[model samples]
Target chain A: MSAAELHNNEMIHGYLNDLRRYLSRLAPHETQEVIREIESHLFDVLDQQAANGQAADVAEILRGFGDARQLAALYVAHIEEGAPPPRGFRAIQSVKKSVTASLYFAMAVFGFSMAFGLLFIAGAKFLLPESVGVWSTPHGDSIVVGFVSVPPMATPEVMGWWIVPVATLLAVGVAWLTRKVLLVLKQHM
Target chain B: MNSTEALMEKWEVQLRKGTLELAILAALQQRTLYGLELLKLLQSLPSTTITEGTLYPLLDRLKRDELVDAQWVQEGETRPRKYYQLTPLGNKKLTDLTRLWRQSVSDIEWLLANPGPQPLPNTGV
Candidate 1:
């Protein structure tokens, strides 16, 4: 169906948003220039289509132009580098995107792992009997430090042996994941 | 398609991309035209199949490179339209590109007509 017939303003807005976001890497003025020209061209095409009594869907025409990101890449590449701009940069960009996604996934997995690991230890200490718990004693509950479980009744020597190193490793991992998540967010934003 | 056909398709796209600017310059050589008029003119040509997708970016690039200049002109009750005309630099560039294109065409035509020799004739060895 024709975008004009459908009067799909939301789809148009979403398309423009994607184009704008894709073009955001260009210098502000350059980005604005490309977008303005594109907008004007799109309007002219639509007007011509309407004048011809043919309801050519604006969305379909935009789709014919291909993906907004790809169009933006072509615009930016040609504008910046002149005619016959080198291709394959989009492949590189996609790889970068995948890496960023991997970082997010890794961060989420690590964050959930740490949180659930700690919660499971706490849960086991409270729910399970002291005799059956990983290291809980009859006196009190157990606390998790990295891979080790430390009961309140444990010896100071055992605590000193595992707690410091395990805690340090877990803290470093959490900190690293947090930093990675922030870095990825910063890049996207 | 096979690898060679795919390669030809890729080259065809590249060739088209290279020629579009020349075609736009050639179109603007005569007089000023608005985006829609220019688009219509190009569409009318048997050699050009460009839609708005390729047109605007090319126009913007031409304007950026100082090959063409644009102005907003209002006519009657209609909205203002950006009209484009070639600059002196664009004219000179167009001439050079046209000369090169003609030479390439001539060279290719000659090559087509005289494609060297057949391999070993009808030798069954």
Candidate 2:
């Protein structure tokens, strides 16, 4: 490539990197879309300037784009108008956004895992007969593992059939929690 | 620049910002142009001062609002160019906005031409 072409390429690359960092919250596809449009526009401008025998100063070209963050904000505002509003200061908002999203995801994954385990236990308890015992010993003591069952140490009160409905509700709660976690993941993605 | 000139410059910026959407719509009234082509045409005009950052978002807004239609067309060997044109709804909007803008400009011009009442010559009561 010619010196001018190399310089132009460097300038465009630098400007795009600045823009990408500023718009980090955007989905990969969205960021690419914006960058592609910009690259096309800049190259056309530069080519025209070159043809006219004028110097296509990269700094001048970038200035024409205005401030990088401001430009990113404009695109973000336009695209994410339907999404949640960014909070606090401009720079802080991006950091807070990613941090918050990651925290929510982590919490959701933890919640879902806990819920799944609990739901499995509850479901197993519901399926097992009330009198069923995990370990029946010759000493006339039975070890119970049911959701509502008292361990061998605790007072052995017979759990009523109503435990089925209660266990069912707990399973339903876990399912709902799973759905919510999936939604949060989808939105972040 | 002096303070008065600076103040005028500030207001001009504000005024231009407001009219840019209208200007873009007007430009697209007759023909379809790709992003760079449209930018060139607007830059050629003395009144319009726009950059890709401002123009693309506005174009995106217009597209989102269903005021403009866009398509990618490729002629052999070159990159596909995205061209934008006005939708039927956009035409209607442009016609209405143009009328309102013209009326407002005329009113402002009248106020400028005749600076009304010149302090109403000291009516001593």
Count backbone clashes in candidate 2: 0
Per-residue alpha-carbon lDDT of model 1 for A1-189, expressed as tens digits?
655555755666677778889987666666766666566666666777789988657777677567888888767875465554234345667788888787776777777677556545444433543322333344445443323343445523234334334544665677676777767665772
Per-residue lDDT of model 2, residues B4-117, tens digit only: 999999998898899999999999997999988888889899788688778887897788689998887888976767799999999999999999999999978866776545
| Leading candidate by DockQ | 2
Alpha-carbon runs more than 4 Å astray in model 1: A1-6, A26-30, A78-189, B1-8, B115-125
lDDT of 2 by residue, A1-189 (tens): 889789879978988999989887776766777788788778777777889999888778788788888998887784455754333235766786788777777877777776676566556654665543343344656545455454444445354555456555766787687778768765774
Model 1, residue A84: distance off in Å is 19
- Give the TM-score comparing model 2 with the true structure, all chains together: 0.61
TM-score of each: 0.54, 0.61
User: Model 2, residue A56: what's the lDDT?
Assistant: 82
